[model samples]
Target: MYEGAVQDLIDELGRLPGVGPKSAQRIAFHLLQAEPADAQRLADAITRVKATVRFCARCFNVSEAEECRICRDPRRDGRVLCVVEEARDVVAIERTREYRGRYHVLGGAISPIDGIGPDDLHVRDLVRRLDDEPVDELIIATNPNVEGEATASYLSRLFAPLGVRITRLASGLPVGGDLDYADEVTLGRAFAGRRDVRG
Candidate 1:
């Protein structure tokens, strides 16, 4: 165990998600050994982000103003809405440069075990947005995990009567992954989403 200010630093670092006590201690020592200016810069960056950054009013993604840049961009298609579980997923999809539609961040997935439900997420906001916007398609881009699937299914049922085209992201084995090593769910999804190959 460390003493005084170092122990305080370790305690604070341990509070971060996925940072256990040992890892927190390791990071604390690493920061202490670094240059004072480097440590100060890291601290300042954290403070600045917390102070200036906020959720976008339109898409619920992290932003500095009322709306995210994607929401404000005129080039993005307003007819298609891509719904995601978190703000990070938005960034991941944006890097692909394939989609040109707006996004709606759900904040989190539905997990009854964790006491997280439809009300806990931004589902109501999504429903409200559907009524206000002229969106024709809703792409459910939740993770391919159990919680993500549940959330997607729940949303699909809720939007079924609305007549919006609902679609889920196709899941399967990774590009370089061997078919033999694939899990049942992934293999099943691949089979269900199979397409005809034209020669």
Candidate 2:
């Protein structure tokens, strides 16, 4: 138990996700030892992000403006929309360079354990977009996990009546990964997603 602001710093750092007590203590001490300018810059950056960054009104992605750049871009296909669990997932999909469509950020997946449901996310906004926009297809790119699957399934049912073509991202073993090290679920998905080689 440290005294005064030192303990306060450690406690605040520990509140960050994935930051344990030891890591928080280390970070607090490092900040204490850091050059005043560097620490001030870090504090300023956090403050600036909070002050300037906001969710895009269209896709809910982090943006400085009302809509994200992707939403404003004219080149992207407006008929195709990729739905993801979070803003970070948009960044991940952008790095792939394979998809050329716009996106809809769900805010988060439906997790009953976390007390998160479709109502808790931006799902209503998505349905509204589908109704208002000319979207013909929706790509579900949620993470390949139990909660993600449940969320996808729920979305599939919810969007079924809309008559839009809904698709889920295929999950399988990574390239160059050995079969022996693969989990049963991953191997099974690989088999299910396999396509016959074209001559």
Candidate 3:
């Protein structure tokens, strides 16, 4: 256990996601040992991010300006819109280099257990964007968990009547994964998503 400001630092660090008490303590000690300039730089960076970063007006991804780079890009496909639960998901998809369409971040999925629902998310904004934009295909790139599934289903039902084609990101066993180690749901999805071999 620490004392005074040191303990306060540890507690605050522990509040961050995935940081346990031990990890937080270690981080706090590291910061204490770090040069004053280094600590000041970290503080300045956090303050700067909090001051400048805000959600994109159109897509809800984290942005310094009114719209994100993706939303501002003229080269991106306007016909297809990918929907995800968070800004981090946008980074993940970008890393894949498989998609060239713009994105709409939902902020979060519908989770009754967590007291979060469609009303809590950016649903109304998405609907508004749909009406205003040229999007024809909405790809639900939400996680494959229960909350994600619920959000996807709700979105599909809500948008189906508008005649816009909606699709979900395909999920199945990962490459190099053994069938014996796969769960029933994953194995089933793999079977469902199977394609014929031409070779």
Candidate 4:
């Protein structure tokens, strides 16, 4: 337990996702011990991000402008669109540097338990993009979990009639991971996604 304002700070910090009571306590104490300038800098950065960052009107990615850098880039392949559940996923894919296409942020995956559904997502925006843009393929990059699978399936069915080729990111046992430790679903997917060896 802490004093009035310090306890309030801990309570507020605990509200952030992934931050628990202990972590919030640690962070609050750390901030208290930190130089006043450092605390002020953190506050300023948070304020700046909230004031400037907005979702890209085109692809819904977090951006300071109307369109994100990827959407604005002329070098990116506009014909291929990768759909992901969140803006963080876009960063993940970008880190790979293998994909050279644009992205669509779905906002979230379908989770009935969480009261999120297809309508709750940005599916309509995606359909509109398909019509407005010259997209040749849609790569579903949703996570391989239950919610992600449902979202992917719903998207596949919805976009099937639109004539845009739909594909999913492959999932399987990770590199250097032993087969014995792999889950059945992942192992099955690995076998299902196997390719013929070539010289």
Candidate 5:
């Protein structure tokens, strides 16, 4: 029912992931009715993030510099690498404070139906990092879904001959739930119960 810029804003917002048309309309109206300063701040924040953030050169996580803070931290264990499907999963694991290792953000999981393959992700970078670093173990923290499983399996096979230990996060995660959404307790348990991937 809205016109011009207001409807345009709703349409743009609706295109974002997880935002339905109704939710987008609600948000557009909320921004329109809110103080100009408040809306401006949100817009500025989004703009700044898009402009300033770059992927970490080492781990592929979002960062303002060539390397992310996690990759630069001397305290994190270089001998252990936690492989995740996305950068958001790095934040989720960090919140638990239970892991003191480094991470590799794969960017996306293998989805044959969607035409995403092993080469489409950061798997090559991960393998290169292993060749350069002294990583003793690789913890696969991909989600517990079909695509995630395929990605994990692919990685396991790729890394098998390298002699590094490969482990997968335990099940009992909410079925079809993204790793980014799992609660700290459940996520921690999965980490603790990680099992070796035997080839």
Candidate 6:
């Protein structure tokens, strides 16, 4: 084990999600070797994000203001809301360019193994928005994993009685992926979500 601030830096870096002890050590050493200005820039960016970035009051997306730009925009459809597990999911959907509706960030999916549940997420906040806003449709855009499916199912049941039309995003194999490489669940979903060709 290292002594003083060197060990302290490594320990701190290791605390970050997905960063292991070896990775944290490497990062700490890399930062130690980096030019002072570059390291200062990284530190400044972290500080700036912590100080300025906050969740939007309307949709819980990361924003500098009370509401995110998507929430503030007049051109977006207020009747439709895409619900996602995280802010990063919002960014991914935005990059697609096809969806013109607004979003609701759930913060995280329901994971029993991880001890997370509906109460742990921003579910109550979502219910509040549904009651307050004119959202007519809710697009369940959670990931297609087990946890995602569980979360989606829970949400589907919870919102079914709220009078909003709910929909789940179709999951399937990638465009160029080979059939042999596809897993059973993915292939089944592909078959389930297939549509007829309009010739």
Q: Please, what is the TM-score per model?
A: 0.97, 0.97, 0.97, 0.97, 0.86, 0.95
- Model 5 score (lDDT): 0.94
- lDDT: which candidate is best? 4
Tens digit of lDDT per residue, candidate 6, span 1-199? 8989999999999999999999999999999999999999999999999999999998999999999999999999999999999999999999989999999999999999999999999999999999999999999999999999999999999999998999999889988999989999999989998999999
For residues 86-197, what per-residue lDDT tens digits would candidate 4 score against the true structure? 9999999999999999999999999999999989999999999999999999999999999999999999999999889999998888999999999999999999989999
Query: Which pairs of residues have clashing backbones in candidate 1?
Result: none
* lDDT digits (tens) for residues 1-199 of candidate 5: 7889998999999999999999999999899999999999999999999999999999999999989999999999999999999999999999989999999999999999999998899999998999999999999999978899899999999999999999998765777899989888779877887779999
lDDT (10s digit) by residue, model 3, range 57-135: 9999999999999999999998899999999999999999999999999999999999998999999999998999988
Q: Backbone collision count in every prediction?
A: 0, 0, 0, 0, 0, 0
RMSD to the true structure for each prediction, in A, is: 1.0, 1.0, 0.9, 0.9, 6.4, 1.3
Off by over 4 Å in 2: none
Off by over 4 Å in 4: none
Instruction: Write the number of the candidate with greater TM-score, choosing between 3 and 5.
Output: 3
Over 4 Å off, model 1:
none
Candidate 5 to native Cα RMSD, angstroms: 6.4
lDDT of each: 0.96, 0.95, 0.95, 0.96, 0.94, 0.96
lDDT of 1 by residue, 136-178 (tens): 9999999988899999999999999999999998887789999
- Indicate the residue-level lDDT of 141 in model 3: 93
- Candidate 3 vs. true structure, TM-score: 0.97
5 or 6: which has the higher lDDT? Answer: 6
